[model samples]
Target: MPSRRSFLFAASAAVAAPSLPIEAQHSSGSGREMKQLPPAIAALTDRRSEAVPIKLGEREHRVERARGLLVKNRLDALVICTGTSLTYFTGLRWGQSERFFAWVLPAKGNPFVVCPVFEEGRVRERMEAKAATLPQASVTRVYTWNEDDSPYALLAKALKEAGIANGRVGVEERTQFAFADGIAHASPTLTVVSGTPVTAGCRAVKSTAELALMRLANDNTLKVYEAAWKSLEPGMTNRHVTDLIGVGYERTGFPGDASCQVAEYSALPHGSLHPQVIQEGQIILLDDGCVVEGYQSDISRSFVLGKASDKQKKVFDIVHKAQSAALAAGKAGTPCHAVDDAARKVISDAGFGPDYKYFTHRLGHGIGMDEHEWPYLVRGNSLPLESGMTFSDEPGIYIVGEFGIRLEDDWVVTPDGGDMFTPQSPSLEQPFSRA
Candidate 1:
């Protein structure tokens, strides 16, 4: 599932007629009107000290690596617009707007930026801050255009000046279509190709520092989930649990959120906007995670409000074994699809069977700076697993109208196999208990 922020934004328009409870609406209590937090949630302390932001040196190294990839991919320049890719390579956290603001990294020269003339000061300020940490903090050239001027033309001219005229230029996968089209129109001789070869090529594998941040992110998310799970009470709505998760992340000093799907809604993977109230023996599934230093963690935990029935236990065990099977098959050099096959086999053998009838979605997805990124773990993907490559080991069995059980844990590929950041959920009753 996507982040709660995105999901809620998309689901806001579809909210049901029923009003949310007071506890679900407000995260923090105000004076006498403030509702008490569950002991488990209230007891959480700030864990900001455990997180470490990515260093400028590491980002610089990433750029150098991208340059080599550019040469290998036979591209002259790479155009990166505002998004995670831009932040991943440059460490500049700029928001995307109608106005054009981009970074053009040529394979052979210092990188440059193209932005609206008025925004130069703000852009340079951030660039200077990052440059301060570099050994060679040379001033990168900036090309600015007025409100009336076409930013794409300026970008094309800048590339021409940088000796990239009439060469193959790669447009980052996420770049806006208009921007890519404008660049192509302005310079018809320039070949605009997919930059995924260079971008995903570099991001597919995690560095030691990146892994550390992801590890902390996963750890923080697990703690938040456990606290929220412990705080769950019968009669409380799904929104209450979501609010608890938000509060738990606040205690950890990280921005995070989650989506709570109850009972029948749990069967619909991403969940529904319909108001749901918790009840005894009902299934509750929480999805999404927190971001620590740009790296993200995606985890899902499914459990029962009170005592779980035999059917729920059976489904949970099958999913748990499938998750384990996928992890075991995800060794270095193994084909990515093989991992999915391993998990699907377990679910299919248990009667959830026959290709996506009950077991829905891919076994997992590659995750890092973005929740869903490149090199997915799905059927027919021939890419071989490599050490340091991280992915979600999520396998699920969804039965329409009944309930769904999905076990997800962020794991990294190892030479021998894979290692999960946290221990898997052993059973529905004790979801967070360590085995």
Candidate 2:
């Protein structure tokens, strides 16, 4: 297999990468202008199609991991109702309805699903299709319970039939709480253990296939950000700019959820998206991305509305350098916290250590079926960066009520090092200089 860095370099080379043209252009809505591109950073939009496919192997790998956990935990079977975990293990994408919702992956027997007949077609199309493609035997034994019947009864019957009559049963915290509670109530002998952590641990590590899809998702998001940046102005409302960003994601043929917040200074790092108006000399922070093929991308960036000050330029440089170093340090066999400290050190050394109050969030998180997954890059996480795992590398420096600067990128850890999924935007030197 090609190293992550070499793969990215080869991918970049194959695109006949064009020299990014960096210039400054004034917005017609306001006299404010911004940089066209940063030097040395090529736009990833050129090769979004090159992203790897999320294959059947990745799905099977997760199911096998769950089975391993079940045997080790001494559980007869595990019940999953969480949307992501259910989808990850059994390929069931049906939503929780007023009726019962669940699926069972037994330690020794076949996997089973409990859903309403109303969602039969959707379950087949979205969930069953995935199961059919896997190497595992067709394990989804559907139990169609009526909307009026007790969903817990149907689930318990299925579990009992599968030889799980009297042992520890695992349940997802989010979706299975009610149904699992009902099942445990019906069968007092069965122990209901929290299965959320087991599920998270199984899916947190990325398979090569999952990493490929994430790379594509993030690549498409890069274009969306560019379009949003171009359409932005001091006069545009936060809603309007965010809407435009959504359009960009859709226009590029990669669609998911796109959300954002734009604030002057009051809305510093990690500020909530609210009703606000942009103004001159203000900063714009965006937290947005799109989901593609069930996998999602979550990214954040900050820009200046009109002209920025020398202080802002220096801060931006430091944040960028820090994120770059963190990305460089991220690789298989390295501790997760070390990656975070690599970025934190750059920010602290820039003389903002005292002012930097909120730079302590995890530097990154796992990306797959869900936007926020596990194996977080935070203090004492200690999870080693494993090969084929993809994660975000975001580092920021923020003063709650004053101002903030953040830079984010996604990377896949290889046996040797990491590869950036979304390359940073070309330099903003011209924008900062003119501002």
Best-fitting candidate, measured by TM-score?
1
lDDT of 2 by residue, 1-435 (tens): 122223332343344222212233344553223354322122323344665555567677777788898888787777876487766665545566556767778888778777888776766676546656443536567788776787777777888898877888888766545576687776766888877557866887777667767877886776667666665656665555555554455445565443344444434544443455667666676666676766777677777766777766777788789888888888789998888888888888887674235575667877677666677888788878877777888888776666676777778888667788876743432222212
TM-score of each: 0.94, 0.77
Candidate 1, which segments miss by more than 4 Å at Cα?
Answer: 1-5, 9-34, 133-137
TM-score of 2: 0.77
List of clashing residue pairs for candidate 2 = 38-426, 38-427, 39-427
Model 2, runs deviating above 4 Å:
1-57, 116-131, 134-139, 144-150, 257-267, 354-356, 425-435
lDDT of 2 at 389: 73
Superposed Cα deviation of residue 46, candidate 1 (Å): 0.8
Q: Candidate 2, residue 68: CA error in Å? A: 2.4
- Model 1 local distance difference test score: 0.86
Find the candidate with the highest lDDT and give its number. 1
State in Å the error of residue 337, model 2.
2.6
